[model samples]
Structures are given as structure tokens and as C-alpha cells.
Target: MKILIAEYAGFCFGVKRAIETAYYEIEKNSGRKIYMLGEIIHNPQVISDLSKKGVNIIEEEELDKLTEGDKLIIRSHGVSKKLYDFLAKKGIEVIDVTCPFVKKVQDIVYEHYHKGYSIIIVGDRNHPEVRGVNGWCDDTAYVVNSIEEAHKLPKLEKACAVAQTTLIGRYWEDILEVIKLKVKDLVFFNTICDATQKRQGSAEQLSKKVDVMFVIGGKHSSNTQKLKKICEKNCKNTFHIEDAKELTLEMVKDREIIGITAGASTPDYVIEEVIKKIRFLKGEKEEE
Candidate 1:
């Protein structure tokens, strides 16, 4: 049996930076109360690790309980402008680790919304990133995750569209095409992160060549779910798993070529663990 991994698998630059910053903040503010706006990233293992280190997840309602001089770590998903204002008014220190790409989308939406253009978001409406982006437009943006949603939108004179960072590329394109027809003047920003595009591309290619594919990441992770969808289209035997334990020996035991890919939030150690587990199950020596 042979094992192949996608060239762009595991945590991307944004996620890696956020995780590193979270750890640094924990150490730097040892005496102060520290809270994360949300899960630092979607990976449970990483969140669990941070929790062990005294990083508690803070929800919107819980924000009021935080006192002045408290530190709130902004997760990579980011929070709305309203949340920022509230934090500032309360004199809370914010350690912002929002992915730069996501920040760009927020800026674009903020700028265009003030220019009399209707804002449209091509992404999951429920995603925290989408919610945060919508906040910039005063929650007036039309959020659509599919071509059908775009079709349902009322005709508009002018609009600006942005996508969730982890959205699938083809879905973004399809939604944009529909939005164009519904609006007289349309401006769309390709806010999908480059890392996301590369990861999806690599996963699709690897899936096509492998007998079995394993997509590793937290089950709730958006990018991980997208990777699983992309892989499933090319390889029917694809499995979406959060960790090595979720995978069983029988799944890949007889497969001649097994492929592994992970979401942007996945840790390198998690990927390595999966690889080692596979190798051990197959009675093969681990790589040095």
C-alpha cells in the first residue's frame, strides 16, 4: 500500500498565525483574565489545548461580564464592528488575530456600503465570518450560499459581493453569475482565500488519483467540510474525520493507494498522527 498527502494540506498561514498568537497572549498576560471571542479556530484539539491553558470561549452575551482591563482574543473568524465598539467602550483590550484576508473583505464591504451600493455576501449566512462581514454593512447585505439563493434575491440597481474566505471556488463563481443577472451594476471581490483555492485544487487532484481519501479536520470546520465535498466528487470513498481515532484500520487496509488531506485549521501533529496510524495499521515502517 502507498500513502499520499495533498501538497497543501494542514493549517494554512492565517490559522497558524492565529494559533501562535493565541499561545503568546496566554503567556504574556498570565495574571489578567483572557477570553477568546470564539473558538480560536475550528479545530477541537487546538481549542482543547487552549482551554487547558486557561483560554475560555466568550459568547456575545458573556461580553458584559468582562470588566475593564480584561483581554479578549479575537478569533480568526473575527467579530462585528458593533462588538469592537462595545469592547472599546468597556475599556477591554483586544488581541486581534483576524485573518488579513477576512479583514480585507470587511473593509471592502464597509467602504462600498457607504457608497450607496447594496452589499451581497456569497457564503453560508450562519457562518461567523459572514455574520461579522454583514455587521460592517449594518446587516443589510443579502447573504447567499447557492445559485438558487442568488436567484431568489430581488433585483438591485447596484451591489458589491464578497465571499466567505473558506467558500468553494466553483460555488462562488456560480453564485456570482446569478448575482450579476439580478443587479444592474455589480462589483464582486474574490474574498476566498488563496490558501483555500490551493488546498481545494490539491485535494481534488489527489482524490482523483487515490483509491481512498481521508480529509482530516474538526467536523465543524468550514474549510474541512468544503475539502470533503470536493474530494467526494472525485473519490467516492472519501471520509471526513477529525482525528486519527476516527479512522479505523479496515477502511484503508486493502486500499492500494490512500490519500490524506486536511483543513486549514488542522494541526501538523494531527496530520502526522493520521499518517503514522495508517502506516502502523499497514505494518509499514514510519517515515523518519
Candidate 2:
């Protein structure tokens, strides 16, 4: 048996910057209390690791529970203008970690919305990042995750488009192509993260060359889910898991070559553990 890992796996630059910023503040503040606006990233393990370090996470429902002077840290997904203003009015010290790539999407959505172009967001509607993007344009933009959903959309003023930062680049392009043909004066921007494009492209190539595909990352990680989607499209025997416990001999049973890829939020350590598990499984099969 063999294991092949994608060349581009694990944390991208944005996630790394956010995690570093939060960890640095945690160590520097010592006794001070800090609260994240949301899950720092969608990775459950990373959030658990930070929680043990005394970082408190708060969502919209928890806003009223905040006390004066408690520090507020924005997550990398970015937030709506209303949320930012609301936090500002609370007089809390804000530590913003919104990814620059995501921030650009927010601006694009807000600007086009105010300009009166009906907006179309091409990504998962329920995703916090997409929700945040929509929050800026509320009544003007419609969120559609796929062509099927887009088909139900009503014709609006000339449409302007933006995508969730983690959207697969090709998918975004295809959706944009559809919108262009649907709207008379359509305008679109490719706000998908370059890192996501590179990662998916690499994963697709790796998947075609391997027998079993192991996609590693947290279940809630959007980018990680996308990685699994890409891998499974090329390799039917793809498995998505966060840690080594989920991997077993049965999953790798008849495969001589295995490919491994991880979501953007996944750490290098997680991928290493998966690799180690595959090697152990291979050894067990050889012994049998």
C-alpha cells in the first residue's frame, strides 16, 4: 500500500494569520478576557485548542452578555457593516482578524448593493461567510449555492456577483457564466481565494493519480468540505475525516496508492497523523 499527499494541504495564509493573531493576543494578555465574534475558523480542533487557552467565543445571540471593556476579536470570515458598527458602539477594544481576501468581497457586495445593482452571491447560503456577505446587502442580493437554485431566482436589476472566499474557482466561473447570460448588463468579480483555487487544483490532480483519497479536516470547515468534493469527484473512494481515528484498514482495503488532501483550516500536524495512520494500516495488511 502507498499514501500520496497533495502538495497543497493544510492552513492557507489567511487562516494562519488569524490563528497567529489570536494566539499572540492570548499569550500577551495573560489575565485579560477575550472573546471571538465567532468560531475563529470552522476547524473544531483548532477552536477546542483555543478554548483551553482561555479564549471565549461569542455569537450574535451572546452579544448582550458582553460586559464593558471586554476585548472583541473578529473572525477571519469578516462581518457586516452593521455588526462592526454595533461592536464599535459597545466600546469594546476590537482586534480584527478578517481576512483581506474576504474583506474585499464584503466591500464588493456592499458597493454594488448601494449602487442599486441587484446582487447574486454564488456560494452556500447557510455558510456564515456567505451569510455575512449577504447581511451587507440584505434586500438586494440573492444567495444561490448552485445552478439549480439560481434557476429559481427572479430577474432583477442588472446583477453584480461575488462569491464566498472559499468557493471553487471553476464553479464560481461557471456560475458567473450563467448570470452573465441571464442578466442584460451583468457584472462579476472573482473574489474566490487564490489559495483555494490552487489547493483544489492540486487535490484534483492528486486524486486522479491515487487509489484511495483521504480528505482531512473538520466537518464544519467549508474549504475542507470543498476539498473533499473535489477529491471525490476524481476518486470515488474518497474519505473525509478530522483525525486518525476515522481511518481504518477497511477503507484502504484494495488500494495500492492513496491520496491525502486537507482543508485550509487543517493544521500540518493533522495531516501528519493521517499519514502515520495509513502507514500503520499498510503494515497491518502486510502482516495479515
Candidate 3:
């Protein structure tokens, strides 16, 4: 049996920055109460590990519980302007770890909305990143994730559109074409992260050459789900799993070639563990 891995597997720069910053803050301020706005990234294992080390996860509703001098670390997904202002008013120390790409989308939405342009976001409406981006425009942006959703939009004279950072590339193109027809004057920004495009491209290429494909990441991660969907189209035997413990002997027994790809939030150690487990299942030695 042979194992092949995607060239761009594991955490992207944004996730790395967020996790590293979170750990640093935790250690640097050992006595102060630390709270994360949400899961630092979407990975449960990463969240759990940090929680064990003393970082507390809280939602928007729980902000009132915080007092002055408390440290609140914003996740990579970011928060709305309203939340930031509220924290500032409460005198809480805010550590913003929002991805630079996500911050760019918020800036574009804020700038375009003030110029009297109707804002539209192409992404999952419920995603935290999309929600935070909408907040910049006061939550009035039209959010759509599919071509059908785009068609359902009312005709507009002028509008500006931006995409969620982790959205699939082909979905963005398909939806953008439909959006162009619905608006007379349209301004669009391709806000999808460059790393996302590379990861999807590599997964697609690797899936085509292997018998079975494994996509690793948190189950709730949007980027991981997109990777699974992309790989599934090319290889029907694709599996989406969080870690090596989810792998079964039956899944690999008859497979001659296996391809592995992970979401941007996945850590390198998790990927290495999966590879090691697969090797063990094949009766290979540690050196091999």
C-alpha cells in the first residue's frame, strides 16, 4: 500500500497565528481570566487542548459576565463592530486575532455600504465569518450561498458583493455569474483566501489519482466540508474524519493507494498521527 498527502495539508497562516497568539496570551497572563470569543479555529481537538490549558470559550450573550481588566481574545472568524464597541465600553482588554483576509472583507463592506451601495455577501449565512462581515454593514447585506439563492434576489440598480473567505471557488464563480444579471451596476470582490484555492486545487488533483481519499478536520468546519465535497466528486470512496482514531481497518484493507488532505484549521500532528495509524493497519514498521 502507498500513502500520498496533499501538498497543502494542515493549518494555514491565519489559524497558526491565532492559535499561537492564544497560547502566548494564556502563558503571559497566568493570573488574569482569559476568554475566547469562540473556538479559536473550528478544530475541536485544538479547542479542547487550549481549554485544558485555561482558556475559556464564551458566546456573545455572555459578554456581560466579563468585568474590567479581563482579557477577551477574538477568534480568527472575528466579531461584529457592535461587539467590539461593547467590549471597549466595558473596559475589557481585547486581543483581536481576526485573520487579515477576513478583516479586509469587513473593510470593503464598511466602505461600500457608506457610499450608498447595497451590500451582498456570497457565503453560508450562518457562518461566523459571514455574520461578522455583515455586521460591518449593519447586517443589511443580502447573503446567499448558491446560484438559486442568487436568482431569488430582487433586481437592484447598484450593489457591491463580497465572498466569504473560505467559500469554494467554483461556487463563487457560478453564483457571481447569476448575480451579474440581477444588478444593473455591480461591484464584486473575490474575497476568497488564496490558501483556500490552493488547498482545494491540491485536493482535487490528489483525489483523482488515488483509490480512496481521507479529508481530516473538525466536522463543523466549513472549509473542511468544502474539501470533502470537492474530493467526493472525484473519488467516491472519500471519507471525512476528525482524526486517526476515526479511521477503521475495513476502510483501508483493500485500498492500494490512499490520499490524505486536511482542512486549514487542522494541525500537523493530527495529520502525522493519521499517517502513522494507516501504516500500522497495513502491518508496516515504524521506520517504514
What TM-score would each prediction reach against the true structure? 0.98, 0.94, 0.98
- Writing each residue's lDDT as its tens digit, candidate 1 over 110-142 gives 999999999999999998899999999899999
Considering summed lDDT, which 10 consecutive residues are worst modelled in model 3?
279-288
RMSD of candidates 1 onward, in order: 1.5, 2.3, 1.3
**Compared with the true structure, what per-residue lDDT tens digits does model 2 show for residues 15-42?**
9999999999999999999999889888
The CA lDDT of each predicted structure is: 0.92, 0.86, 0.94
lDDT (Cα, 0-100) at 60 in candidate 2: 83
Better of 2 and 3 by lDDT: 3
In model 1, the worst 10-residue window by lDDT is: 279-288
* TM-score, structure 1 vs. true: 0.98
Model 1 Cα displacement at 146 (Å)? 0.7
Q: State residue 173's C-alpha deviation in candidate 3, in Å.
A: 0.5
Compute the lDDT of residue 210 as modeled in candidate 3: 97
What value does the lDDT take at residue 219 in candidate 2?
94
Instruction: Point to the candidate with the largest lDDT.
Output: 3
